[model samples]
Target chain A: MEILIIILLPIICTIMIAAVGRKSVFLRNLFVLIPTVGDFLLVGHLAWQVKSGGTAASLNLVDLSNFAIKFEASGISVYMALSMTFLWIMTAIYSFGYMEHEHAQVRYYAALVLNLAAAMGIVFASNLVTFFIFFELLTIAVYPLVVHEETDAAYLAGKVYGVYLLTGGAMVLMATVVLYCLTGTFDFVPGGIPALAQQSTFMLTVLFVLFTIGFGFKAALVPLCYWLPEAMIAPTPISAVLHAVAVVNVGVFGFVRVIYNIFGPTLYNKMGFGSVIAVMAAITILYSAFQGLRQKEIKRMLAMSTINQLSFMLLGLVSFSMIGMTGGLLHIYYHSFMKITLFYCAGAIITQSKNKYVANMGGLAKHMPITMTCFAVAAVGIVGLPPVAGWVSKWYMMQGFLEMGKPIYAIIFLLSSLIELGFFGPPIFRAFFRKEENNSFNFQQDTSKFGSEAPWAMLAPIVIVAFFSVLFGFWGFVPHGLVKPALSGLLGKGF
Target chain B: MITNSWLLFFAVFIPLVSAPLSLIFSDKVSNRFTALSNVVNFLVIAGMYSAVSHGKLLVLELNTGFNFKLSFMADSLSLLCGLIFIAVWTLTSFYSIGYMSHEHAQRRYNLFSLLSLAGTLGVVFTRNLFSLYIFFEILSVASYVMVVHEESFEARKAGLKYILMGIIGGLTLLLAMVCTYHITGTVDLL
Candidate 1:
């Protein structure tokens, strides 16, 4: 029941907000705050339960003769659920100011809550059926938020988003049924499902292809991508969560689940599927970084960079070792905080200075020092500089690949970092040293004026999440300690 | 294993079970009921997870004979796919409430969407390849209305293309099924 309520709370709030949110601004604001805060506490308690070495909290809400609807909060699920709720609360708080002037507040807030619920559902679902359900829900629920502006471009983006995801969903459904026919079960046993080993090579290969294409569309794997950058027409907070926290994370989670939970490392290695995925991820890493450099729009550039960074996580996951998988899972948490900080900063700059293109900002640092500082810090973190969270994950990922005797992947990792620096480095450099050619700043005047920076609601979350990026870097022990056990539980082997 | 055969059968055929009601009621009522049934279907699938994981499989056999028998099995995998199918359908229904607010033929859209969902769920739960093939075809036919929901010329053209491709695919699958059945002297893989 407790587990059920955890999933239902956001849904309940969504309905309430949708019903009463339009009439009273105070009620709308309160509706968003109370549910998000409640979710934080509920997930916090679940974390405590896991830390105390209790059995993972579970609920079987519907019981049939042959199956049941199951929700389980294992260590990994708890870790991710906690991160999701935390980011959600912060995003909700940030939305208070970011969306102040936006129209259709009711729809925006309602969809935001629904998206969180669906994201949480994805994290906590105990099996593929459960996961896929929430996964598709996320795709549909986010459509409203994506097309909230109701512009021609927004509608086009929405169509693109729908087509890509629904098609992916269909393939997933077909693969899932075929998988059932072969294996007779879809429960996510640790390592790999033993029954799957009995399948013929042709059948197994087909399943692999189906699962990859199904999840890859959402993960934005190359060739099947382009929808992600198009999805940038969404509102800034929506963009921030979609890119950093919710949608992409679910995609990577599904990919990792297929490799680690469904296929297991031993079988994955024996079949040589790891290298195939690693190669794909490596290409995505390099290609998106190059694309990032070419984008003129700030958000589009960040979207490109997100595709790049996400593949780093994918590469780490397919390393097929305890350390590699740990790095992969840990990167999910670390990247969420770090990339979300960057997106938040981007959104803040746009909301404040009305500059959507990077080229338009000649001397942004001269005025919005706080926002620029946060952006620079996150950019350095993303480039794998020391004492930032991104570096910690990349280090473990490189080590994992080398331990697996795959030095090529490690080299790819190194090259991708340089690419990251190439794109993220310049904006910071231009902000501080190289002033824009068409500048608007009055240097002689006091630049620390209150209005020069974004409002407190917007600026506070950026600074907080950025601080966490650096703080996690320095205190890498915390996530390393958490994710290690989670990966171990899934792999059924202690590192 | 406790096998409630009637309930299990109804779970897979719920869309057909509710079709009569859908046709009789107003669009709003039918939409709400269809959405409610999907939620119920999702819960039923979820409830079966523990039993399936415990190795308590549900097998419904039809036309039993010495040489061949038709069967439908509920295992972990089928149940999992069923969950995803119902989830997508339910969310689409909710989204359509808002998305189709200004559209005509909403009743037609809702009915076809429900029928497509039925075909999809059947495809997931059917144990034999022949039944699987049948459900796949049903899904293809039912989903045509969704493709052409807009009633625009482009929509009609797209719908025609969609049905043509679906038919071609169905024919190819049917040919394969015939060969397999003739070669093996049985249509069921299980």
Candidate 2:
């Protein structure tokens, strides 16, 4: 029932939105807001239920032929669902302020809520077919939000996104069909599907290629990566949510499902698929870092940085060790919090001052001290600096690499961290150390539509998400409560 | 919810049927008509989409009394494209109201736009080379009017180049159709 309500609630809310939207803005906003908060509580309740009971909550809707439309909330999925819902709460608040001047609130909010529903479906999906269905739904649901601006650039990026995802979806469908044919099961067992281990190495390898290449379009893995940067033309809220929570997360989350659920860690290790993915992820990490350094726009830079960081999560997951997988899962939560914080800051800056370029953000801290402070904190978290949650995840990932007898991966992780600092550090520094090149803008004026300090609606989420990135750093045990159950749930009790 | 309802099969023809309605109205009225028709088209296609996703394969078979058969399948892939096309066309309808507010020949643009959309819908819906070739031809030719709507030397020049290239491409498609039918004695795409 938790699983059913989690998927159906937002869809119901979206219907209510279309009905209520024409009557009053407040009611429409309420329909969207209520479900987000409600979903977080419900998912939290469900997560707690799983943690305590040691039994996942499952929903079997129907059986189609030999397949079933089902949902289950395991430890890691609960963590992902929690992260998405939590980030959505922030996105909803940030959007209320950010979209004040924008058109199409009915369409935007509806798509946003529907997207929230689709994302929940992705995380809670217990099988490959169910995951694939929600995966495609997610792509379709986010379209209106991404193209909300209706500008030429927005459409261009939307075109790139559509073409890529369409082809990607078809590839994924083919792969799913092939896997179902080979093994006759779509259930995601924790370690590895034992039956899949008996398949020929060549068949499994090709299946891996199909799944990776298909999912890589969304994950923005190097050759399939330009769409992420191009997607920056969307409204800042869309960019933030897509980068942090929904769209890209779906891709990386697909990778998690592929590695753990579909391939399983042990079989994946034996097949040596982990090494190939790690190498690809390493290239993406380093290459995106360099690309990020050259980006002038803060959002695009964040976009590149996102491509870099998502690979970090992938690298960790494919690192072929328990600690590595743990690090990967932790980063999924950490990255969303940190990245959303950074994006919310960027959105606030873009909205308040009408400034977007990093080159112009010099002395920005003087004007928006609160925003830059949040940015600084998130930047520290992203680069794995001490006393932040990012450090905890990165430390584990590096340790996992070393434990696996792969010092080179550890070195690659270190190098990307420095490059990330080179990219992220400058904006925060210039925001403080340098002088405002444009003197006409005045924070004291408070003339913008939002407020003197980027409306509370926007700033609050940024500060809150940023603060969580720090809180998780200090309250490290909280992650263990989740990750241990998740790891053990998949690998069995002894693990 | 899954049904082999006949409306689901011929739903692609809704646009082709409405394309002429745009020519019957003036500029202001045509925009609204286009919007209305597109909404109707969207709702029907959306219904088709629901049926397809729920495991109903919406197929249309035609006996043309020639050496060829016309086959159309609204698989999930085509339905997705159909849905996207309608959404984009609806958005484009709203967009043109603002962007083309000052433009002339709005009626001509509106008429061809629906016709081209019909063409696209046909192309996406068909599962056989026979129908695909016929729809592909409609799409290329209908698009010519849109390119030449400006009615200037450059517009005509570009339109000519576009149509010529489109024709060449169509011919290549025909070549492929011939090869497939000659070999398989049928043009069904699986």
* Prediction RMSDs, each to the true structure: 29.1, 28.1
Q: In candidate 1, residue A299 scores what lDDT?
A: 92
Please give the CA lDDT of all the candidate structures. Answer: 0.78, 0.80
Per-residue alpha-carbon lDDT of candidate 2 for residues B50-157, written as tens digits (9 for 90 to 100): 678787777877654233456677878988988898889888887877777678778768877887887788888877876676667668767877897775668767
Listed in order, the DockQ scores are 0.01, 0.01
lDDT of 1 at B22: 73
DockQ category of candidate 1: incorrect
Q: For candidate 2, give the lDDT of residue A161.
A: 81
Mark the regions of model 1 whose C-alpha exceeds 4 Å error after superposition. Answer: A439-448, A493-495, B1-190
After TM-score superposition, the amount by which residue B66's alpha carbon in candidate 1 deviates from its true location, in angstroms, is 64
Superposition error at A226 for model 2 (Å) = 1.0
